[model samples]
Target chain A: MVKTNKQKAGNIITALLLIILGAFMFLPIYLTIVMSLKPQEELFIFPPKLYTLRPTLDNFSSMFDILDNNRVPFSRYLFNSIAVTFTVTFSQCVFVSMGAFVLAKCRFPFSKLINSVIVTSLLYQSNVIYIMQYAVMSKMGIIDNPLALILPSIASPMGLFLMKQSISQMPDSIIESAKIDGAGLFRICWQIVIPNQKPALMTLIIFAFQASWNMQGGSLVFQEQYKTLPTVITQISTTGIARAGETMAASVFMLIPPVIVFMLTQSQVIDTMAHSGIKR
Target chain B: MDKLKKLWCDVRKNRDCYLMLAPFMILFVIFTIVPVIMSLPVGFTNFNMAQPPEFVGFDNYINLFLSDKVFTKAIRVTIIFAVITGPVSYMICFLLAWLIDGLPKKLRSIFTLIFYIPSMANVYTVWKIIFSGDMNGWLNSTLIEWGFIQSPVQWLTDSRYVLGVTITVQLWLSLGAGFLALSAGFRNIDRNLYEVAYIEGMDSKLQELVYIVIPSMKPQMLFAGVMQIVSSFTAGTVAQELVGFPSTDYKAHTIMTHAYDYGWVRWEMGYASAICTVLFIAMYVCNKVISRLFKE
Candidate 1:
């Protein structure tokens, strides 16, 4: 009876600790949602209300109005973000997978050098090459193009590394048998390797999508006309009239696509991370 | 006929793979490699975007190191931020992971999702609201209502508090991937090791954790540490925004923002490149030392 009581006390303590931590994690999100619903007057009310007294869509409507008046087409920015994200994600998966396959299966000369370079690049952040990236983009006259953002970010050494790790785990005899059957590198990679790499591909897709979607610096560089959603949302929230609710609304909108992508690919991402020991 | 057949087979076999890879390589060279190389030469010039670059070899690097006060402050700030936040955040994440490891699977997943949502949410905007200078600010209002403070604190504008706020946010936003990775590591531990320890009458806590947990989580911990270091070094955006430009007497300016100021706003490409090179070397050396120490 005493032991059971001790166990019960321990369980309660554990539950309380988790609940507190969980609240800390959820506070910002909850506040944002509440702020988005509250009117401007209610926003600044002393002793800050936890829930909206009167929920309204005025904040959402005003955000749109502001966008319209400023000649900043929010839809265009959203579309550009979506387009760039999908294009970059899709391309990165294909390229990274191919490179991974080649490195894993193909016995090419200078493979070690290539692998080293890829690893170095993976560890290196864009800030290291910021000056060069800007200069080259200017020289190429692609400063304001979406390609400037999409093209550079797609050369993902991390993706290649993940693919290599995934592909290396495959039975070597399978590739050897394919080679014996007169399967060339390309045929073997496509027919045998890619189909077998569904988990890695899905993980890559999630990572690529998240990276592209959350990309702030790269998108900030080029394409003034074709502003990505993050830039647009940031600009709106920071520079414009200080409507807290509208800013929250914009943030909420900006967050939805990645959340959807995360939900769709969550299981795959978790599974891949478990098996392959890759973290994004 | 043999040559024709060989060519046909090659085309049939390698085309898809090449096509799949072409986009990445082409894009990488154009955006990444070319730009990196291009930036190197800029370090030798004094060219603003409006004017042609005039060669002034080593001048930028010399000025940055010897004369640029902002550059020095940036380096200091970045190092300090990284030094403080990197280890603390890692510990917090690991602790969270450890705590969650004790939960039931279904409850653990729910908690994990909740913990990770803050990271996924629009961080910049949320922070802006939380730290809003107005009395309506959630943090300020709450504190005032609770009588914790007599007056509102200028959390964002005050230079002393800015870095702290930035680090706190960093800790909050940094919980997801590292925690998830460690949790996964915990889940994958060999149950037999713990069983053996228990049979040997080893204490439950030490048996389950020190013996079974830490050893199994070495790889995950290493990966998380390396990633945290890289991110902490590069991540000054929150600080940049919160502290405002010029960094409130240059206290909050990190190497990244300084590089941006020189490269973009001032168009001093050479100077920016020099700073970037310094940052890269510093980060590389740090990564090397950490990796050697951990030896993962």
Candidate 2:
């Protein structure tokens, strides 16, 4: 395990490169935190500052103040965000898991067509269909409702694709044994197969939570009370340059929960992402 | 009648699978499938929200390729964006993931989080502070201080810098899920394979990568390629977020932005659907081609 001096130098070079690249990646997210804490005087400095000589929490208080002063209280926005986020994430895990199990194991008519459709859907940008989607959402009577933010996100192709890739990696023997034991399809999907796919489930949970946490019913759901925190935060952000500090504070506010969720489950997510691709 | 009976029996035999799939399928159809399918028919029509969709045949698409100046400019900007950022960011993701893999676990996780946070945190808008035109903006002031420019560059507003600035920001957010997949792909490789390859006569790390790592990580690479291609082709949000929509002179206009400009801003749903359809087809074809290349 002893490294030669030449080998040590190469290793040092590699470490140096990683640090430089890692810093580039980390800069904006770090600046979000750093800039949020800057005092008002620092905001207008000629050649704006990257670091604050005088740090303060006044920006956050003002952000909170703005939230407090809104026609919709901050708590209502927060509540909508939390309720929608939790419902979408939980339901996605359940529904995508169920569908992914059949997609992985069962050979029904049109299964191949369904699988191809789902794969192509993964590559689709939801923006492409937004105009039509608004119409569809209205037709479903979910427009201007909390369901606008929650329902469509509950079963993404990405979630189904992730779970299907993981589930198919499970041996058929295990499912076969469960089937022979007279376990119903639902039991096998939920009780038996799913428990063993923690990494994949965690991956779905992280993505779903991240997407839902940041979901804004922007133009889709017109009601103020039903909109998520991000929609409200963007409204706060429009106060212009004099209020940039509060905007930064609001950005930090919206970012915190997802970052926390990501950190908590990242190991599982990292493990699962590696294995999420085609069977080939 | 015999074939119908056999099909019925088969359907009954696997009804549990149907039952398992129906809930997700219903939601998926309502939310994802139906909308996308509906857009295809809309692409051929002249429909606004106010009126009935009049069948327009190929007029919308004909206008896009033959008449729309902004659409052509959008295609140009998008291709420039895809060509530069797509491969460059893919290599950076791989290289960063490879180096981070070399670090200890604690540092590894921290580095991953650091690189991964921007995409998650909606950091595109945060870049506005840096690209802001005033002397108070970070990039502007820094360039002034360094004597690179006499005046604060309108980084976001200027036509000169919009594409570059947007490309830079898109690259920042590009690590995303694909990077994580590659990093974990590195971890899952059996270390013993490396030792065996080394002892069997591999001397350089590059050799080890070609011989040992890549052969074991095909699936992850394919996934990363598909993700990188999709993100690059669909990279309108970063530009629209960083620069204003219908960016100055349409310099930063992209297919996605063009679609957004028409669909949302003007409510010209018909033409917008055509633009969206074109972009989606381009993305899907690019994905299929990249996946094919990755397989090879």
lDDT of 1 by residue, B1-296 (tens): 99788767765665654554566667667776676666667668887777888999898888988999878888888988898888888887787777776776567767767776776676666676678666767789888888998888888878888777887787778775556555555554544556577678775454467767776667566656766777788777777766577767777788988888887778776677777777777777877787687654
* Prediction RMSDs, each to the true structure: 6.0, 3.4
* Model 2 per-residue lDDT tens digits across residues A45-161: 776667889899999998888887977888998998999999999999999999999999989887999998997987667454776688899998888888888899997887787
Residue pairs with colliding backbones in model 2 are none
Model 2 spans > 4 angstroms off: A4-7, A126-128, A168-196, A267-280, B1-4, B184-204
Chain A accuracy as TM-score for every candidate: 0.79, 0.87
Model 1's TM-score against the true structure: 0.79
Candidate 2 lDDT over residue span B1-296, tens digit each: 99899989998999999999998999999988888888778889887879989999999999999999989999999999999989999998888878887777678878878888887786654688878888877877888899989987888888898898889888988888678667756765656677777778777768877887787767567667777887888889888888888788888898888888888788888898888788888988888788788668
lDDT of 1 by residue, A203-274 (tens): 567668878897775343545558786766666665322566898887676667866775665444333324
Give DockQ per model, in order: 0.34, 0.49
Task: Please give each candidate's TM-score.
Answer: 0.79, 0.90
Query: Which number leads on TM-score?
Result: 2
